[model samples]
Target: MASLSFVNVCKTYKNGLTVVKDFNLDIKDREFLILVGPSGCGKSMTLRMIAGLEDITSGELWIDGQLMNMTSPQSRDLSMVFQSYALYPHLTVYQNMAFGLKVHKVPKDEIEKRVGRAAEILHISHLLDRKPSALSGGQKQRVAIGSVIVRQPKAYLMDEPLSNLDAKLRSQMRVELAKIHRELGATIIYVTHDQVEAMTLGTRIVVMNSGVIQQAASPNDIYENPVNKFVAGFIGSPSMNFFPVWVARRGEKICLEFGKNKLIANEICSKRLVEDGYVGRRVYLGIRPEDFHEEGPEEQKILFDVEMKEVLGAEILFHGRINREEICVRLSPNVKAEPGERLPVYVDMDRIKLFDMDTEQNIIYV
Candidate 1:
């Protein structure tokens, strides 16, 4: 296992279009870090740079304590499992797993021992003699992972390795991959555009955009307190509802006005936002689907008319509009809802986020 670091990493194609901008992150040994972003957002390019498949335009990449700016991919002591399971069509599973070692002229007995153990770990021992054509997509994926496992490198780099499977199989493999990581204690860097995969598989996640690092933190932290509007909307399903609001002095108390309602901000939000040179200026009220509740007794939550409800398994997502601004609430599955109807929804005062409309920076409550 090894720690990986990228210091001031940058990547530019031949057209001089920059894909990464002073990207920096520290991945601890044995840590499962995920790089998540929309496609063409430099996540794959960053991984390729680490794997030495693409040369770094500038800056250094490090593994453990070694400077690997010019190191060959093979000398990086890492293994990669890609989206397509590149298993040999003619070779049996055992042979495909052992091919790397065989090419290096590793002893035949040692190769068998490593392959056997990996197959057992991956639970593919029974299918060792099967050809890739004979295996299910999931089984083939497991074999691809097992092929890497047998090598037992310092770290593993996976680029959307489970993307090709069905949802059920992807769910199953998520568990298996976690188990494999724990059992082997190998560091792993995974890249995926799927937020669910990033949230579930990563101990820490780095969210990127436009070739820049937006936020890097644990899943829980990023979910609960995203650094900006992009991270806030990108990390959650159904996305967060954003609407324009203006801070105003109504009567005597300071409040944020949305449409016809004067929703009071938390004292912290009011203080930071009011003093951040934007008091009485336009800002965006950030609210998550789950943050809005059907019952709100507080004097602060904005009221809305129910527009629609999407029942997802055990939870219901209530879509509403307040002063023409769209809103959402996560309700229990038992709560019956209808569209174009008036329903009282509460915006959790303590769970609110305020972002500068122009800068998109979180107006951190002091």
Candidate 2:
């Protein structure tokens, strides 16, 4: 419902500790923007700054074209949902959902209408008369979200609101939150350490690390074309595998060499390596777990000494050594494999990524 812009925002505490550095981002109206990283990466601090809960040490925060540096939390027209479902334990679901509206002295009929609509949207209409102690974890979370929805704020700020739920419930709520976003058309700024949540929920994801914005883009772009090694390693589930290899030229062909193994570089990678003068230099070779295949060209195959295996329903994860470097490979469950076995696996050369050894930046993308 509103656009938010952070222009060179930085937050430093009195102890001289800076958690967010030179942060700049523009959140579009009706956009589900996610701020995601490891703990202490300044994602929550950024969200708090937007809610006027934290003071901006420097730079500007503009909400819908108005400077809101000194605005109070209540005056900011933003609602925040925390990890802990901060519900009035003694109050019924209906009362908890209606509390904010009643505080503003909204008409009795209007409060009922808003609460009813929110309850229906959250699929918690049947539990309206129940108190917090009587509802399940998922139900209580829905009530917490329902409370915020009734406010009809300009944007919703969520700081890992689903983190408290169990794994199964968390999965269920992810779907619900996506549905709510579509129905309300509300602008939401969500902060989380869970990359899965960031990938599934956000229309755009901002990957941060140690106070800096690493990469901000659509989920597909960030996954397929990461700006650097940190973003690439952090966004994926199994994490991308990296190997330090020398870029070598065998006449017209370019290859990545590590230990006794070699992978022929694709045409694009070969040209970049040659033109960039990386031949015979060491760089990090990145490959996702899914990129390894059980079959391929004989020359492209490498020996994988499997040390461990994980059978995850539809797929199996082989953890072992390839070219003397530890790596993980995801394969269909239809394939049979066991520990202490040496298997030949092929890598998808076109999907491999090369990173500068010193800077750890993706060569092709950066």
Candidate 3:
């Protein structure tokens, strides 16, 4: 395993379009780091730069403390697994896994040993004699991974390697990846647009957008305390609900008003707003779908006209409107809900998030 670092790295096209801006990160040895974002968000561009497939407009790339800004991809001591399983259809699984070693003229015995070990680790030992055409999608993927495993490179770069699999197979491959990481202790850099994959597979995640790094932290930290509105909305399923709210101070108490409902701001939120001199200022109120409950005290309740109901097993997502703003509430499967009806939903005050209206930044969390 090896440590990787991107120091003030950047990528700009000849036409003057900058895709990655002053990118900086420190990847520890054996760390499984994930680059996650929406499409066209520079996640793939960053990976390409690291793999030496693209030129860096400026800055440095380091691997194990060696400067690799101008190093060729072949000399980078890294292996990349592409989104498509790039296996030779004519070769058997064992031959495909051993191709790289043979090209480098490694001893025949050594190649066989490495191929056998990788197949065993990936649990594909039974399919070694089968050609690529005879293998399933998952099996082909494993062969692609095994092809790199035999090289014993310093790090592994996987760009959406599980994207083409079916949903159930993708879920299975996630577990297999974690197992592979444990057994090999290989440093890995993974890129994907799937938030669930990012949350489950990455030891640390870097959230990116429009050529900028928004947040880089553990999955739990990013989920509970996103740095900005984009990170908050992107990380959660069904997305967090946002409402235009006005902050007003009444008799030494700070309160938030949305529509016809008002709730006292928690101590942390109140203190931040007060210090920022935001009394009577409009801000965005952020809350997760799951944080809205069907049962609570009347003081915490807010009424909304349910517009749509989506039934998901074990839970239901209720879509409603409040003061012309759409919001979704996740409730228990047992809760009775219907469209075109008014419902009193309670906000979990302890889990509330507040963001600045103009900046869209989390006030308390930041």
Candidate 4:
């Protein structure tokens, strides 16, 4: 296993296209770190740089205490699994898995032993005589990974390896991949645009946008304590609701205002607002869909009517408009709701997020 670090890393093409900007991350040994974002976010580029498939334009990449700027792919001590299986159709499972060892001129008996073990671990031992053309999509991916496993590299680099599989297979494989990692104790850096995969498989997630990292944290931390609006909106399903809010003092208590709605702030946030000098300033209020409720006992709660309700399996999403801003609440699917009804909303004052109006950066105390 190896620890990886990207220090002030950058990637710029010859056409003057800057894909990555001052990217930095320190991945620990045997850590399953996931890089996630939309396309063209430089996630794949970062992986390529680590794999020695692409040269860095600037900065440094260190693996296991060694700088890997000019090292070739073979010397990087890494195995990569691509979106496409990249398997040799003509070669049987054993031959395909053993090919790398053969090229390195490992003894025939040793190659057979390694390949056999990999196939067994992957549960493809019975398919050793079968070619890629005869295997299922998930099976092909397993064979591809088995090929990598036989190499016994220091790390595994996976780039959207499940994109081609059906939903059910992908889900199954995600769990299997986690198990395989534990079994091998290998460091893995997986790149995917799928948030579900990123959330479920990673020990830590690094979310990138436009070649810049937006946030890096554990799944729960990333969801609950996003640093800014972008991270807050991007990390969750149904996303968080944002609206303009004005900070002020109402009578003896501190409060925030949104159009006709006004709610006294909790002690924790009131203290923070005063400390951050946000009193009497226009800011943004962020609340997640799941955080919204009908009503709760607190100093105050902002209520809004339901304009629409969507039943999605275990949760019902309430769509309501506040000051021309559309907001939603995820509640129990068992709740009875309807359109055109003014629903009383129970805002969780303690769970609310505050952001600076100017920079759109979260102002909540970390």
Best by the TM-score measure: 2
Writing each residue's lDDT as its tens digit, candidate 1 over 1-366 gives 899999999999999999998998999999999999999999999999999999899888999999998999988888899899889899999999998788768899999999999998889999999999999999999999998888888899999999999999999999999999899988999999999999998999999999999999999999888899999989998798888888886665568787777788777876676567666788888888888776776665566787778878989888778777777788788776678767666778788788888879778722
Ranking by TM-score: 2, 3, 1, 4
The deviation in Å at residue 186 for candidate 3 is: 1.4
Q: Model 1 RMSD to the real structure?
A: 1.7
Error of 4 at 179 (Å): 0.7
TM-score-superior candidate, 3 or 4: 3
For each candidate, what TM-score against the reference?
0.95, 0.98, 0.97, 0.94
lDDT of 4 by residue, 123-205 (tens): 99999999899999999999998998898888999999999999999999999899888998889999998988988999999
Model 2 agreement with the true structure over 1-366: per-residue lDDT tens digits: 799999999999999999999999999999999999999999999999999999999999999999999999989888888888889999999999999888888999999999999999999999999999999889989999999999999999998999989999999999999999999999999999999999999999999999999999999999999999999899897999999999998877998988888889999999888888899899999999999898999767878899999999988999999767889999888878789999788999989889989898888994
* Candidate 3 all-Cα RMSD: 1.3
Q: At residue 31, give the lDDT of candidate 4.
A: 92
Between candidates 2 and 3, the lDDT winner:
2
> Candidate 2 clashing pairs?
none
Pairs clashing within candidate 4: 305-343
| Candidate 3 residue lDDT tens string, 132-249 | 9999999999999999989888999999999999999899989989998988999999999999999999999999999889999999999999998899989989899999889998
Q: Which candidate is the best by lDDT?
A: 2
lDDT order, best first, reads 2, 3, 4, 1
